[model samples]
Target chain A: MNLYVKQTRSISFVPKSILAVLILSFFIQCFWHFTFTNFVAKRHALPEPPKASFIRLASLDDSVSAAKLLMLWLQAFDNQPGVSIPLKELNYDRVIQWMNLILEVDNKIQYPLLAAIRFYAEVQDEEKQRKMIAYVSNKFIEKPNERWATMAHAVYMAKHRVKDVALALDIAKLIRQYAKGDNVPYWAKQMEIFILEDMGELESAKIIIGGLLESGELQDAHQRKFLGQRLEEIEQRQKKGE
Target chain B: MNHNLLLTIAKYSIWEAIRDKFLIFILLGFITLFCISLFIGELAITEGLQMQSAILGSTLRLFSVFTMGLFVITSMVREFNDKGFELILSHPVPRSSYYFGKFCGFSVAALIISFMSFCCLCFYAPVNMSLLWSFSLFCELLIIIALSLLCLFSFNSITISFSVVTAFYILSRSIEAIQLISDSPIVASGSFSYKFINSMLDVIAYIIPDIYKFTQTDWLVYLPDVKTDILIVVSQTLIYVSLISCVALFDLYRKEL
Candidate 1:
């Protein structure tokens, strides 16, 4: 009876051995999460914000769940170990598929459109880049901010990498037509100037800046001063060329 | 609905859920994730609230759905394995009462757990919008649980029931996306094959409720009161759950225990 009592007493509120194992497991998991998992996450950080789909879904109508799934697929695709693969061998067909998936859900989303353009540009696939730019131009014709930002980025890429002034100028003209608002930021106006200067169209740069300054839309004193300096610099350069 | 019988069953189900060590595990996991969100918030520095709301809202929604599904299927399997359902049916209990009871039980259990998690969030980073999302999420989980019970009755095997129910939940979530592919220009203007695919997706779109509308965590960060939207969500859940329960009841009536 005493032995039985002693044996029962040994097992108190909780067993000591089980408590030790639980404590040890907690520390082990903490170490693993802080070290191993953290290291891997840092090595392969997501290029785009992860919950962008959830935000878009909240903001958009219908087809939002489809957008979420496509975002998940994009994240998974980006997380692939493709870094070791030769740059030339990196096929952009998957990128196109992911873009189409996102666009299919909500064509208004600028993130996927921008992502497609950047991915194709990175791989130096001018064909895919042109295709993406054309798609964005046609589909987002009404969304001026989205259209201008995307097309401007495309124009910048074209002038430097592809050396295609025609493509750059075409995008610039679209910007001129649709991106008209008092709210249009100065950076967008600068993009057109940058494209023209890159194409040696200093005359167009002078005219665009003159129009911007005259409109009084560059309301901030700093903006007005910056535009005045740029116009003067362009005039000096144009005269120097003559 | 048979209120008394329903209450009894639901009370029993809540008791079972409370006694479940698995539910405790899930609660612990939720708390851990919330802590991690706070840690991430610290790292973000400036946009800490936005980050915490997004992470906590999404994590809670996903984990709660998973917990509800696992709990329903496991409980059903245990009852079946032990001939517990047979013993209950051997009494004066009507099949509908038993079925409704199980649904009520699971919903209450889910409500309690979700409410507790919401309180935990309040302790860390309180937001009125989080409560709205959590409430809608509870409704969504209730609908999922009802559908799960239907699946459990339809398919005798727990594995098949769990898979089919989970698959159904996933498909419901992605139905909008499936419709998008079908309605794409290529499909709309393409050959007979594409039209046929589009037609099938149209039918599916009609069948599955658009759950994306209810599970939006974006509002948790931006909006103060999406009360009208939450009302619509709860009403939709009631209609869906009722339809699903009716089908489950019909199936259970015909089923040989």
Candidate 2:
């Protein structure tokens, strides 16, 4: 009788035991959760802001070559191991495909569509570049800001790809006229003056450079020294001609 | 007269839920998860926003399905197993009030838990300081809680209720994938058994509320320009909850002690 009573008592304590176990398990789970989370946080250090890459696309000829070269450049851009791959890289092929797809349906836009314009400038196909610029200028006469990208493309086409100093100067002036005040970067203004100097428009270049020096925006010692040296060189060239 | 008795019962039921250790533990767990997510967000140098959004969204969805489902099943089962319903019905409280009171208690507990969890998420996730997201999250939480409670009340066994709810959660999460699977050429080419399985999955996807619809953590994370219509989504959630709760209430009223 005593033995049976003892067994019964032990059996009665089973529910209490189970309850205790559940509570202990819950606490242990909580502890593990926090510990694991903190461990992961400590393991991966925050990454640095990525450096931007500049690619000059003015040397290729055919659309296929342009597409292939763009893809190659994009692969290099997107090869960042820890950081996010650049959008320019990931969307490169997508942009090319979109151009092909759109061209299949309609090719009648007065301005070469966005994709064709980009491809033409990138590959430095002079005829295609001229057509795109003319089309853009005619079609987007009212929306200058929208045409800013194409204007930049024109500058690239004239200077780096086609080597047309006069046309580059013309496009640079247009860029200066459109990108005024807070909309423009100071470096862009400097680039405009450089283009004018390259085109032998020395007087206009000197005025722009003098204005830049007065504005105090070009205050960095290295930039000031470089601009001063370039100005001296241009003045020496003109004096020699005189 | 019986309404007052039901109100008192409901009041006590809510108090009981407040004291539940399980709910408290779940809240703690969720808070920890949110904090961890913030730390993880700091590591993502480039796609930090998108990563944060994905983590927060998936975490909230998982928390809803797991924690809320467990609370509903256990609480409902305990009430039946402990014969607490008999004690309440024996009082001056009407049977209708007793049942309604229990539902209200569970609903309120779920609401409070959801609200607390949402607040924690907002604090941790890099969301823009928009009151709209918080309010929308609250509404979604209520619907999820109500859905869970309905599943619990529909089944006799707590284990079965839990199983059904888990299955529902899985189906809801994978509804798009399931649809794609059904439409795949491989499935089409397979035997009759594969086709039948795919058809069954499609029926489940159609029948169940895709809980994924309520998840807006991604938007909060990404801070996208698009704005979601809150009123329409809330109304849809309310309709689903009301329909389920009504069925559960009718069944509960007819159930014998």
Q: What's the true lDDT of residue A106 in model 2?
A: 22
Alpha-carbon shift of residue A5 in model 1 (angstroms): 20
Give per-residue lDDT, candidate 1, residue A83. Answer: 42
lDDT of 1 by residue, B1-257 (tens): 46787788888787777666556877798889888877766644133565566567777777788778978988988888989899988878889989989988898888876786677667544457657767888888888899889888888787898888777777776666556544555423767877787788788778777686686755655454677788789888988988998999999999886
Model 2 misplacement above 4 A: A1-242, B1-3, B47-50, B92-96, B124-136, B184-202, B225-229
For each candidate, what TM-score against the reference?
0.60, 0.52
The model with the greatest TM-score is 1
The chain A TM-scores for the candidates, taken one by one, are 0.60, 0.42
lDDT of 2: 0.57
Cα deviation at B67, candidate 2, in Å, is: 1.1
Model 2's CAPRI class is: incorrect
Mind sharing the TM-score for model 2? 0.52
Model 1 chain A lowest lDDT segment of ten: A1-10
